[model samples]
Target: MSVSINKITVLGSGVMGHGIAQVSAMAGYNVTLRDIEQSFLDKAMEKIRWSLNKLVEKQKLSQQDADKIFARITPVVDLKTALKGADLLIEAVPEDMNLKKKVYAEVDSFAEDKTLYASNTSTLPITDMAALTSRPERFIGLHFFNPPQLMPLVEVIPGAKSNAGMVDMAMDYCKKVGKQPVLCKKDVPGFIVNRVFIPLVHEAVYCMERDNASMTQIDSAVKFRMSFPMGIFELADYTGLDVIHKATVEMHMRDAKVIFPHPKIKQLFDEKNLGQKTGKGFYEYKGDKYERVNLTEQEAATYNPIKLLAVAANNAAWLITNGVCDRAELEKALKLGMGLKKELFATMQEFGPQNVVKTLQELAAKYGQFYQPDPYLVSYRA
Candidate 1:
């Protein structure tokens, strides 16, 4: 059966929630931005208005169109009212299974029998959450990147029991909202982007600790040599070290062999020096606003950026051989999700598969088995 979603009910009015609601409305869907308190909803509305105004000022959106889009998003504090006539319910609440189960129960009691359920969880397994609902087949994962209003990538993940039609509908829904959807065939921890991304960032930390490489040089090499939008350490600061620590710990818990929880990251997370939000992490920021890290071309000479990209390539290879996603989708995920200037596989090809594998092997010997080259990567022709 084909699934059609026209009305979206978004639970939680925090950053991700409001962004998702704003984009859905921009895509012409009637959206209900809901929160437990009116104040939360009010704040979300203000943020939405501010974002729309920015688009208008930049001429990306007309004032008339922005007003129309804002009008389409109805802010509500009541759960039942928000769920009323919603074709899809996107749960963007805090990442707690217990809290999510309670919300699902409430949604089950009020939502229409036909309403499809989607979780915007970045770390949790979709299958486990799907099991909490009566309609596990209707439960799917739509992991949007931070600031969904601007980020184009969305991981469309399906639980073990998710209906095939519903998965397709989720992908279509992403495209409708101006997102490039990548299917994470299995409900693996971290899905596609995080699965590959977490380890690459860890390698940066490893380089800093073991190789005694300066953070500025490492980031400079990554941005200048690899054409990455930001340096790995710089990205950690932008994303918040606490957030990386949490994600690393969570992913490591599920797959200990693949993910290593760096002591430095944990220490920062423990200390609450979260990143730009806290005015410090890998680098310092003033007034809680982001400032681009100053890196010179000469600094890029100190490090070989392939060391980090090799980690991502190996992880991408594992995902391919394990049937999580194919090569094309993996490349697309890295490019759009991570904002890489070049395709990851293309870069791997430039390094040559044999050399990439050799680097991983060398890293594995130096580090732990986590850097061990996967069989797929070893046998890769290109």
Candidate 2:
């Protein structure tokens, strides 16, 4: 069956929620932005107005178009009002499994059976929350990057119970709302993007904590030699160390055999130095300024990224073998979503899966640390 998503109900009025509401409204969808209190709704509207103004001033949007877009979004404190006639509902609430389940239960009561439900969760599996809904076939993971108005990528993760039609409709809806959707074939913790990409960030921190390298050297090497615009450590500071720590904990829970950068990241989070938000993380920020670390070009090139890339490749292989996603989709997501050079995952395949294992072995033997090899990679020699 085909679905026409003309009305979008966005649950939550936080940064991501409001941004999603704004984009959906701008796309000609009648969007209802809901929150528990009127204050949250007001703040979200304020942010939306500011964003629209900036776009208009920059000529990305005309004032007349901005006003029309702003008019399409209706802020409501009532859940029923938000859910009524909503062909699609997106939950951008806090990342908690049980809490989300409860919200889904509430949404299920109010939303029509035909309404497709999606959660913008970054870490939890779509399967976990899908069971709570009577319409399990309608549940999916629409993991949108932060500031959804700007970020074009959205991972369309279907649970075991989700139907093919649901996935297709969700993908269609994503394009309608101006997003590039990637399918996470199976409902696994962290889905595709976090499952494969975030591990590299963790590995970078682990290398730092394990005395394998200094933050300065790692940052410089990543920036200058790895062909990446920003180092993982520095990116963490900009994005949020607390967010990274929480995501690591969630991912680690799902795959306990894997090692993560918990100790150091958690320490920073607990210290209330949650990256740029608090003006300190891997580095301190003082009034939009921060110090720089320098490394020689030769020294930077000598610093190996393969140590980090190995973990990502091996984990990606595990994901592929487990049916979370395949190599091609993973490559596309990494390239389009993260703006990474195509060589990262391509090299992983070119280097052979066993070479990933070999890299793991070398790292473990030298540093006395290694994640248990995925069973899929163990049996196959190729």
Candidate 3:
């Protein structure tokens, strides 16, 4: 049977849920946002109205267009009522496995037989979530970034039992919602972005803990030298160190191969330095004012943003060489999904794979196992 996502039912009415509903509605899909309570639903609707008005003010959308989009989104407190005619159901609930499984089981009973079930989970294994449904073949992970209405990337993760047709339908739906879709062949922990990013972010924390760099210097080096949108420490402060700490522990429990636990993360969480949400973290935020922690010049230079970036690029290269994904798709995902520059890889390739492998090996010998060259890189040398 062919599947067409003309009507989308989005479960949960939090930031991600409301944003997803907005994008789907803007793309001409009728969206029903389901929440457990009227108060929650009202708050989501209010946020949606504010978001649309902001878009109009920015000139990115017309007031008339925003109204049409807002009109297409119907808020409901009942799941069955909201999902009655949905062609596709997207769950943007909290990333607790039990909660997700419970919701999926309910959705399995309430949604249409042909409805495609997708999760916006960033870390949990999609295969595990698919097991909750009778029709595992229809389950897929459609991981949209924060502010789903604005972020361009949507990872299409296929669980082990997911139907090939379902994958195609999910990809088509992502494009329909005006997103660039990248397929993940297996349900790896953290999918793609978080798998690579979490480690890099953790190492940044390690750099701080060891007195290798101060928060400001470390962040400045990455932002200015590597052109990263923000320094890792700054991003952690904005994203909340506690949140990253929880995600790191969850991911570590799932896959112990990568030891991403950092003392800084644990200390911050223990001390209740939860970033902007809690008023302090790597940096302090007091109302509208911000203050960065100090660092020495030598500590700043020791972090080496270029070398760290090269490690990431090397890892990506190994993934591409091993057929995890094609070069173009990997490049596209890193560029569009992570907001990284494409030229990083192009420059490495220009320097040659052999040179890159040697550089990685030297770093591995010095920095520990994390920088060890993958077999693909070793094979390139052979």
* Model number with the top lDDT: 1
Every candidate's lDDT: 0.88, 0.80, 0.77
For residues 1-382, what per-residue lDDT tens digits would candidate 2 score against the true structure? 6888899999999998999999889889999999999999999999999999999999999999999999999999999888999888999999888788789879888888678888888888778788888888888889888878888889998988998988998898889889999898877767776776667777888777664787777877766655555777777787787777778888888876544555777889899898878988887777766544444566676576666667876677678788876667877777666666654555555656677678788776775544656666666543
TM-score of each: 0.96, 0.90, 0.89
Candidate 3 on 1-382: residue-level lDDT in tens? 4776788999999989999998999899999999989999899999999999999999999999999999999999888898898888899999888888788878878887767788898878888888888888888999998778778999889999998898899889889889999987767766666665677777676556654656677776666555555677777787677667877887888877554466778899999998877898877777856655444445446555655465666556555655557667776777776677544566555557677677668767876776777776566531
* Residue 274 alpha-carbon offset, candidate 1, angstroms: 1.1
lDDT at residue 137 of model 3 (Cα atoms)? 84
TM-score sort, best first: 1, 2, 3
How much does candidate 3 score in TM-score? 0.89
Q: Single out the weakest 10-residue window by summed lDDT for candidate 2.
A: 288-297
Clashes of each: 0, 0, 0
**Higher-lDDT candidate of 2 and 3:** 2
Give the Cα error of residue 94 in candidate 3, in Å: 0.1
Candidate 2, clashing residue pairs?
A: none
Q: Estimate the lDDT of model 2.
A: 0.80
Clashes of 2: 0
User: How should the candidates be ordered by lDDT, best one leading?
Assistant: 1, 2, 3
